[model samples]
Target: MPDTASDTTTGYQVLARRYRSKTFGEVVGQESIAETLERAIDRGRTAHAYLFCGTRGVGKTSMARIFAQALNVTDEQAEEVAVGDAILRGEDMDVVEIDGASNNGVQDARDLIANASIRPARSPFKIYIIDEVHMLSNAAFNALLKTMEEPPSHVKFILCTTEPHKVLPTIQSRCQRFDFRPISVARIAEHLTAVLGSESIEADEAVVLRVARLANGSMRDGLSILERVVAAADGRLDAALLERVLGVPPEDIVKDVASAIGAGDPAATLRAMATLLAEGLAPERALDGIAERFRLLLAARVCGDDPALLGTGSEESAALVEESSAFEAEQLVHMIALCDAAGGRVRVSASPRAILDAAVTRMALSERFARAASLLAGDVTVSSGATSKKKSLKVADSTRPTPPARPASPPVIESAPEAAPE
Candidate 1:
């Protein structure tokens, strides 16, 4: 079952906030971390400080809130749903949610230090959840070092940062660190399906999967994209509607381009590129799609139709395995490299279309270059099973034997002619 909170306010709430995980078990894709935190709380071994580190939309802040709720809310207070709700909503006096980006100063740190000494208003623990903690200046970090190292028994700290590397090492050392991983595509897709079902919106599996892939392992991003789709949905969602809303080229067009490149057909490849450009797909995005296709193909070639490795459905995995046979692993690697180089140039190039065209053409003609390389490297083998070596070509009369000692006679005649002239 999907875990969701009801929004009673008249104002609209985005899916991300409305569907935020309220309990540790409701957290998606970070089950191990959630379980560990839950065990610590159950064992009465809650730490004084914790550092949550991960990329955006991967539940760092959400996990912090859930942890705080678990620590401060007891069974006696469980009957009081308002208390748990306040903590989860980050509105409780005990759970203070601070945006470090906005209040990152020595004074802010000092204020936090000063407030830590005070007791909780209602809850057992007074928790400070500082998000984007790496934004604090050096002086601010230095000010908080001692407090973070040794806070009052009633006070707890939860530090969250997208970039953990930027946080001072001394601060990190004092807290128990939990590194959150990016959600998997399968998990994101499943979660999206559940969300759509809850909203009574029906979407094609392909559409849901496409949105999940576009989310790129961020559940929040997946929800945001799905929100846009739901807002624009008419009746039932389909692939055409998805492509139209996202303004991306159709999957068939991308596959056509990849097939042309794999077949070494420059004209067909350019025609496919023209179609993509005519459809208003950005050149950089087109390049990304092509690169992604080749990446899947490479995976298929190496891993042999493993859907897990390809991150595709079984049908798509089979199709990729079939398509991958058109190009060798080495050719796919070279094509991917060409796409990467062109991608870099396309970002800054005034004529991105031209760059894309040239890149596809180079990929289409890659076999010719491979052949030329083989010839240059003297690797040509003959029918007699003899390998050629780099040497000067010579014409020899193999059928006839030549007389010996003619060089000595020629030298003697030349010496006699020189003596006569002297």
Candidate 2:
């Protein structure tokens, strides 16, 4: 008997794999590029060689496959779901997927060139999809240049890369390039919401939003996160479970620390951080949460308090807007920098707690400086921390001794007499 346990036919399909876009219409967060490509297909203006480039998991490879499908897909197959599935599964002989990072030698390029010359096994057009195309050796690129520049009329090349700049300029010049942008947090959340509904799994909107933000603009990553959360939830996924699963602190923890920093209270800030540590939150976790919070606050400061732009719920948006008022734009920028630097240091530093503490304290001190500046400028408004019955911050006083009254203008009568003589 065959090894049934090892068979993939009965294996579980990951959400990312199950929901991979089979048609252009199913693609998310790249509507403009999809529309442009659709128009090109309609007009029969498809380029011989195409370059698709973007950050990881942003659908560079998927779009390449879709383009290939569109090129070779028959009019009959256009409306057939099985045909589309076959194309996505790479079961169609005409569409070949090549990993450029592995087959990066000159010999591989030569083999590709030879293969390009051959006619399609079944479909009208022979398509080659090479992913991470930048990893190909210089010699391989040189060998492929001539054919890439002028290939057989029936042959199509779709080059996908995360770092397009690494590809040789000559090769890039020979192809029509389309840049895939990072999907926005909102689009990812919207897709995740639909995904949860499709799975019949109930998830709090906050959980979905958190997952979207955590994915950092990668649909594949968002789906993966959703899959993990669903697997762990047993049915219902909420913000608490999501945070626990992600090793992130609670929203209130971050908000408290932010409010403390805004209040210019080092003691309160450190106290909040200590509470987080005592609760088993790692220093890096705290730092990441704080950094993310500052990012939203900064966005709110710059983006006119739009909840969509901040990618937050109504309550969170209100909190962000309120927190945004606690600091000047420059102060937010400075705090973000401090948190970022601390984050970098904590990754390698021997004492992450020390670094995090210092970072939070530095932010609090910065607020104090801003408050002192305002006080010096005759703005009596100071930070709450600055006003203490036990201790007071004496500003520049805004009072000068009147400069001795300028000696009464040195007797204007004598000056008038001198003017008459002159």
Candidate 3:
């Protein structure tokens, strides 16, 4: 009989597993890592010690579990071990996962080494999954290193950690390392849709996408957000509920503001912001939303390989890259810093609109106006104030490759035109 744990009928299926990609074919993105691991398994060149490193919510732990499931198998009832099962049963005994923070002691390391000597009771080899191995104390690491160098031929070890630098260099040298990258927002969105559908949850795609973007490339985080949305959506998983629950501003709304800013329309930008405020959007959340989008745009613009990871549309991606090409990297860096500083203040300020407005005002003039002032002083002769002024340029919401010049708009003098030149 198949394991009773395989039951999918109940709502107990967490988003992580409901959306878990068991085989390499199912895992989206991370093609390079997957392909390399798959090849290692196929060729029997698998290393005795393996190090899987990446950020939390990425696939370090999941991939570790997958590797354990792949290289070690079992007889349904007995302790017989097999290889190449192609599926990892969640309850397999051959696979033991250790939480390093809780179990990082010399005693625990010794116990693991002792267990490593014993052959798989029913599977081909006993697989140990040590998560957050960097937390292991120096003594614990030393105890484990001896066994790691020459564990029994049938025994395999997989260590997953977010901070590989803390791991002893000797341990790192012993393992075949594969770096897992954060999942793209599109991939996370795609996964969320499949998981929500599997659970028969009634949620809008926009809501799901919002949670995915908030997850910030962590599949685990995305799932957690999905679970929250499922509970708070009250049977109608709309975008508003998701944002409210997460204390986040809607990505689309932020994109609209970015679009307005990119188009160099001060009136339109302020109008959109006002609409958001009128609709009861928190000023702090609003600025945070803008900050997130701008940061993502900065990343996408610099790294042209994956815009989807940045939650950027195809058209927007093109525009953003074009905008990014205008300034030296330092300009974007400074803009993000200013927005971040403003966001920090807005989060705590009673008047968030004022704070955000100050941020946007600074962004527009921080570099350009200063430079223009210098030029007017006859210190320089540069004529490209238009390019330097768009702190919001990286979002690329405009249709043109680059936004139109904004120097055409001048503040009204109010005074008569020099009183007919005196």
Candidate 4:
């Protein structure tokens, strides 16, 4: 449910709001938690307080509304989700939503404590949803502790927070806690595909996958990115169009940079860096992309090239495996480190391109050093043992002997020189 109060003034609804989950089944990527809550609802064993914890955009608040709706729905109104919609829109009187960030003072807590004893206005339960509950002051939490511990049978409390660690242990002990996990990229991509189908919008699969990756486990963010893409693209969504929209360097350009580093070509590495900068790709973002590829390659070497685990398409994973063969696992780890260091520096550096170029060049040189050292050491494979500490990989070449000792000519040379002087 969305706030329909201001759409006349704004004239539009964002996709995230328009397609918000209306039912438990519609909430993607949180099946386990949803099932648990639904079971609780069915059993009529609702907890007095629930602490919903997770990262932002993972629907802690939405789940709270769902629980509230399930608890308060009547026989006649079972078909209609108006109560749930009202709670979602923050317009319900009985289901009050308090922004802990704004009303986190002692007075606000006292007011809430006073109201906690009252019965519901319309529904069976009076639900108080506190968003970002960790923002509440110490005194405020203390004030609510008594009510939360022993509230009226008709009252329920739902507290949502991104930072659960900041919440007091005493408060948490009195509530049922559910930790929400981040949505996977594949789940998000499927949702995006369905959304595009609903809108009759044509988008390339690659573009959707890229958007999902960019979303980084947030469905709201993925929808927001899709909204921007839909607004920007008059026709179908394609790789080239998305690249421009996201300011991401082309995949080929990033691959070329990786290839150069793998093949130990410093000039090519710098050229790739220049191309990325010329394409208006941020240095930090470029480094991150490079680092991700290296990470995928390392994973391929260790984890057997599974696309799902790698979070890349089959073709891309194959390409990574092929490119990854150029350097040892140790070299890939070193490359990732260089990328991480350069990424940190580019954030504050005035000349980011220079820093990026240096980083890539350094990665290439590192490959050279690894190759040279391996050759000199008789193709020794450097690997860590059972412990985290590094172990020396020494390969002894018995054929390569120590050089013969020089003849003892020093005594004769000194005597001859003395005779000449005399």
Best by lDDT: 1
Give the alpha carbon lDDT tens digit for every residue of 99-182 in model 4: 999999999999988887888876899999999999999999998888999999899999999999999999999999999999
Of candidates 2 and 1, the better by lDDT: 1
Q: What is the lDDT of residue 119 in candidate 2?
A: 96
Candidate 4, residue 414: CA error in Å? 49
Candidate 3 regions exceeding 4 Å error are: 1-11, 74-90, 200-205, 234-237, 251-284, 295-334, 344-357, 364-368, 375-422
Alpha-carbon RMSD to native, per candidate: 7.3, 6.3, 15.7, 10.6
The total of clashing pairs for model 4 equals: 0
Number of the top-ranking candidate, with TM-score as the measure: 1
* Model 3: how far residue 220 lies from native, Å: 2.0
Task: Report, for every candidate in turn, its global Cα lDDT versus the true structure.
Answer: 0.87, 0.82, 0.72, 0.84
Please provide, for model 2 over 308-408, each residue's C-alpha lDDT reduced to its tens digit, 9 standing for 90 to 100. 88887877787788788887788788887887888889999999888899899989888456557766775655335546332233435435454554455
Ranked by lDDT, the better of candidates 3 and 4 is: 4
Off by over 4 Å in 1: 1-7, 380-422
TM-score of 4: 0.84
